[model samples]
Target: MRLSNKRKAPLYNFINTALIMFLVMGILAFFAEEMRFQLLGMEAYLFIAVPAMLIIIFYLNGRQIFEYDSDGEALHFRNRNIVPFMSTPLSDEFPKYKFVKFETFTFLFFKRLYITINSKSGNTILKYEISYLTWKELNDLKFSLNKVIKNNKEKVNDE
Candidate 1:
């Protein structure tokens, strides 16, 4: 089935980093007015390095998806302006499907949703950092996945 949601604002993972960099640069710039070459050099480096790093990180991971599809065989996750990430052989013999929310206080990054598929082989399949999704999208994805699992279960029961 096809599932989608309205796109929301991009979630920035480098906010704290940007803020700290700005603060440090401001301080260094203030001190550099006294002709401290070392501090001036540090400020220059910080001014360039901080935004450059932020841009690189944003480009690498900031693309967020508003829709996904699972057609009983594979999972297709799509995002804006980037290649979609897909998973195949969507397992059905899982003991349970768990939804989890994880946050990293150190980096000020939060993930609003994660799906963990527990398998009989004592292994788990995990999909992480789905915070960009709206509630509707999340629900649709859950529903589609459960439907697949249910069908698989029924097929096994018939056999």
Candidate 2:
């Protein structure tokens, strides 16, 4: 089973908007100051660095995809961009993984989730931050994770 979850969060939107505004402001500041490298020594560096960093951040935030692949016995986390990558398996031994949900109180209520994988080596915890997931996606992820966990638990018991 392959479950595709799209996580959209206002926090990312906010950050993207803020970054864009900063880029614009930085550009204007660069030009308005007449490229005075001596007077604006540190600020001059912002022009080149901010755009480069923003491009990377945009690619990472915009093109992310997470997949739960049961048949392959793996959870794949990917970022669809120039750099394509997959998550490393927990370990050679089949590790036990479970999903946990918790709520955060901000201006509004937000629900968060994380995956805990237990292996012979150690335990690995992957937290799904509010910036990466919305409440709806979190619920869907929880449901899918619960199903996977139940099946694994049953298989363990049967063996």
Candidate 3:
């Protein structure tokens, strides 16, 4: 099964980013004035430069587009611009058990699924922001991931 990117709540990312940026800007405004008043000139610039750089980076690369090909056991994520240099693929062996976890709030407005792959080398986690997925797609992803993980584990055990 192939799961293409779903676009829902397009402004969700923008809202989150704006909220965090606003908080940082507010802090800088409050603190910078206080520091200048107190004769701490250099410290004021540090506070502005550091977080401003971080916010710029976050706005540029924080949101990604995810593409999943379950039949091929490949998952790919890339920056919004779809640049090949920014693409990341998470494809390989599956974890032993409980490789997927579903998280939802009580109100159920937000949902996320995390798929964790563990190997001899390290662990990688792929997150599915289900708020952007259809109900059928979300269920299929959970089922397909579990099925693949179970099959991989059994094959390893047999050997």
Candidate 4:
């Protein structure tokens, strides 16, 4: 099976554009004397605080593109942020027999996928940010990984 989120790029781009516009407006309000003191009788701190908080929230709820492929005796997983040039992509491909286990964890607003593989030295864990994947996609991913793990275990017992 192959799964990817290339279709969601436009949605993420829209969110990024809105956030940037908001930040620009916030900075403008900070400099405008009348808007800062007169409009809605709001505090100047609000303009600064709100935009900063929005940025933090956006960062925590990372917008990323995720791909998972399990075919031809191997599994491939790739994760990259939507923001270009900000961070490097995470990718891993290992044989089905090497797949040890898979787990997931949620921190704050984002979800993570952890894949563990047995190596000569020790167990190595790879992490990927999966916050942007929908529930259906997540279920598909979990099901695929679990199937591989089960097959690996059975193969070991047979041998």
Top model number, lDDT: 4
| Residue range with the least summed lDDT across 10 consecutive positions in model 1 | 97-106
- lDDT (tens digit, per residue) of candidate 4 on 91-153: 889888989998999776689998999888999998888898888999999998888988888
Range of the 10 consecutive residues with the lowest summed lDDT in candidate 4 = 33-42
Model 2 quality (TM-score) = 0.45
Each prediction's RMSD over C-alphas, in Å, is 8.5, 7.5, 8.5, 2.0
**TM-score top scorer:** 4
Model 2, 1-159: lDDT tens digits are: 444443433444566567778888877777766555457766776886777688565644433334444445555433232123423322122333432222333233333334566645666665433324456655675666677778777877899
Better of 1 and 2 by TM-score: 2
Per-residue CA lDDT of model 1 for 10-95, tens digit only, reads: 33324535655766775566567445655454456565566566556554443444456565455554544232342222222223
Query: Candidate 1: deviation at residue 148, Å?
Result: 0.9
Whole-model Cα lDDT of every candidate shown, in order: 0.49, 0.51, 0.53, 0.84
Q: CA shift at 46, candidate 2, in angstroms? A: 16
lDDT of the structure predicted as candidate 4: 0.84
Query: Model 3 misses residue 152 by how many Å?
Result: 0.9
How far in Å is the alpha carbon of 134 misplaced in model 4? 0.9
| Candidate 2: pairs in clash | none
TM-scores of all predicted structures: 0.41, 0.45, 0.44, 0.90
Clashing pairs in 4: none
- How far residue 113's Cα lies from its native spot in candidate 3, in Å, is 1.8
TM value for model 3? 0.44
